[model samples]
Target: MEINMFFLVLLILIPTFVLIIQNKRPKSNLPPTPPSLPIIGHLHLLKEPLHKTLHNMSHNFGPVMLLRFGVRKVVVLTSPSAVEECFTKTNDVVVANRPQLMQAKHLNYNYTTMGAAPYGTLWHALRRVAATELLSATRLDTTTNLREHEVKLMCRQIYNDSSHKVNFKSWFRDLTNNITTMAIIGKRYYGDEINMGDLKEAVEFREMMEEFFIVMHTETLGDFIPVIRWIGFDGVEKKMIDLI
Candidate 1:
């Protein structure tokens, strides 16, 4: 009975001692930050349109400001001089690896693509292949006729609709899409599938791509709390998979 009571007392005392020790530790050694609350950290202090908030904070904290988003520490570089230093002086060290994302993991052909690949032999090989096969002068020359034909078609469409007030935005988007499709797949897919819409399946796919980008660019707690990623708090991984 005594041993049981002692064990329970030790369990409670050990955690309390650790907490006291942690509290006594000097916070001056840590990086500067805006005052924040517990659990949520600086999250509540952030204003809407986070980029703007960061920009505002930079005026007080200098060009390089440290921000805590949830449990993560992020360094924001706001000045062009600082950005130039990162790109020119510390280019290799600064741009070492791409951040792993759910979409890249599940849908980027296992990260075999150049966009998602790390800076290594495989990435170099993919870059070389893309440069030679897709961006080469020979390839561009071969596709020149297709590009011209598509542009001519676009001109005709604009001429036919000259009298009407048309949406130049949609028209330009369709033209761009048509040109890309003809160049890449050797076919135009605009306005083909009825179920997809009067616009082609490719246009629908473009809309989906836009939505995926919007979500990825938005801030989320998982990005800050690494452990929360294990629980899949935002269903980010699943949404990424569905988008792909």
Candidate 2:
């Protein structure tokens, strides 16, 4: 009975001590932040339609606010003047790079791909190449007919349906995938690419695309709470690595 009481007291004391340590603020001339809970910081304050939640915070905590999501510190700006000032030539290097995420390691060829690469010489070169050759205005103009054909196919599919109810998101994604595939490579997964004999392959490709977006968009706890990664509790990150 005595041992049980001691254990209960220890459990209660440990959490209180941790919370007290986590809530300690440092001295800095920084923007104001909302009162955050220990460990999770301000994560609980977030809600759907994230933009509206952020705007509401701006009304309460001024235009520029410093927020913490688990261990990650974020600086949010609602005012146009603050945004413009931060993005000026002097602060270009500070805010130019994208945040490193689990998806970047898998889908982005271990962060070397143009979409996820850090803002540096490689990224600059990739943007220049894309602008000049791959995604140039001339290239897009030439593919206008191909894009139209994909849209027509989507329209025809919808028209053939007896009831208008359908997964509009899937149809839109298929249309987008068709355009991107046909533009970069002269091949497609839908429409002209598949016949009755290859229907299985087409179905497989569609399922794969769906799964890709599902995994990519899903949240990773390690992203916000860095310790989850160091302690090897990153199952989501592992799944992403295995996927690619």
- Point to the candidate with the largest lDDT: 2
lDDT of 1 by residue, 1-244 (tens): 9978976886577556646764898876544567664435577768889889888888778887677665556668888987788777558656667866556666577777898998899998999999999999998999888888877887788888899897878777877877887777666666332244335666676788678777666555666655456668688766776776
- Please give the lDDT score at residue 54 for candidate 2: 99
Candidate No. with top TM-score? 2
For model 1, what is the C-alpha lDDT against the true structure?
Answer: 0.71
Question: Which pairs in model 2 have colliding backbones?
Answer: none
Alpha-carbon lDDT, every model: 0.71, 0.81
| RMSD of every prediction | 6.6, 4.8
